[model samples]
Target: MNAVLRTLVVLVSLVVAAPVLAAPAADVDLVKQRVAKVGVLRGEFSQEKQVAGFKNPLRSQGRFVLAQDHGVVWTTLKPFPSEVVVTRDRILSRQRDGSSRVELDGRQQPAMRSVNAIMFALMSGDAQALAAQFTVKVEAKANNGWSMQLSPRSAMLGKVFTGLKLQGDRYVREVEITEANQDVTRIHFSGMSETPAALSAEEGGKFE
Candidate 1:
């Protein structure tokens, strides 16, 4: 996928987790149901997005790995080699050729804290808890999982997603991130596998 589009997807789908996919797989329904059961996934995805204040959309592609308790990694391997690692405590980001940034809740960066909260909600896939946290509405849901539409319950979430759409299952298929300015970026996911795959802890954190 295009780098800009992938970036947009990461910014949107993973506003709270890794980026995810490469190819379509069989038993698509079975895969989604599995995600609902396992709750952790390893996959790759190609995405495209458009944000506010930008004339054109941004595109990108990346890999995603998630662990129910350990954490999640979203890595963009093109245009730039960058990664975000989210865990129980913090959301940390590093770029292969850039600075590594770390922010903890109620400690330093307020923006990072808010982003952490949102990502936590996303990773957990707890609709009731997330709904309580944000002004979220379930646009759709069933055995296949759900699509949660979220708005800022407080000024905090608003700053990150502005207007957020999370397409859920075990792995996400789409995420739409909008800015307060009404600029919209849509990330559609395909070619994802929800197979019960695991990554070593150290392997999970490494961007390369």
Candidate 2:
């Protein structure tokens, strides 16, 4: 081949091969770091719940917040104003009637236990962490997004839902959590990102 033609061919090969390589673990870690920096997440979601003995699946809508270093605050905005606060130490809940209840160990209530399991799944995308609780696998990948499939690792989780599809898109597009007994709960998050603002102790009192 001519000198100029050979030089051109080598340059094209390098350009084509560069993007085909997968990023290192550290590079992948950067994606999580940027997400964690926001410090908090506020979102709206719709839930469909079905249990072992329920005749019909229950449908509800609500808002939730995940505060940095504290815990998550889940507020039901439709069909009720019930709220669930899950902290590092315990899980507390309230209803529209202003009644308060606390359950430190999720094992106490079947529903709370199921809910907590789902919440933790949405917190991070660590492969090992999720694999421990669910049979997780990559479903698809693209330049802009990816999809992961997960099934509860435990029978208790299976009692709540059969499978889940955690889709990573513009701000975690959708969390499709389904009940093993034929109920489905798909929650979509939006208009939320990490913020530098902090939740005040007094302001947070409304939660407890």
lDDT of each: 0.55, 0.54
Clash pairs for candidate 2: 38-194, 38-195, 161-179, 161-180, 162-179, 162-180
Q: Report the poorest 10 consecutive residues by lDDT, candidate 1.
A: 18-27
Candidate 1 lDDT score at position 1: 36
Q: After superposition, how far is residue 57 of candidate 2 from its true place, in Å?
A: 6.6
Regions of candidate 2 where Cα sits further than 4 Å from its true position: 1-37, 48-58, 100-102, 105-118, 140-143, 206-208
TM-scores of the models, in the order given: 0.65, 0.65
Where model 1 places Cα greater than 4 Å from the true spot, the runs are 1-35, 97-114, 141-145, 159-161, 168-170, 194-197, 201-208
Candidate 2 per-residue lDDT, tens place, 1-208, comes to 2211222233233332222222222223323433344456666777665544677866777777776566677777777667667754456666647765534443543334334433554654443445545666664456556566776655544554578887764356677766555555566666665553776674377545
* Candidate 1, 1-208: lDDT as tens digits: 3333233333443334321122122223333343454546676756565655677766767787766656667777755677776665555566756565533432443334444445655644545445544555654456666676766554534554577777866556677767766767676555565564666656554523
Candidate 1's TM-score reads 0.65
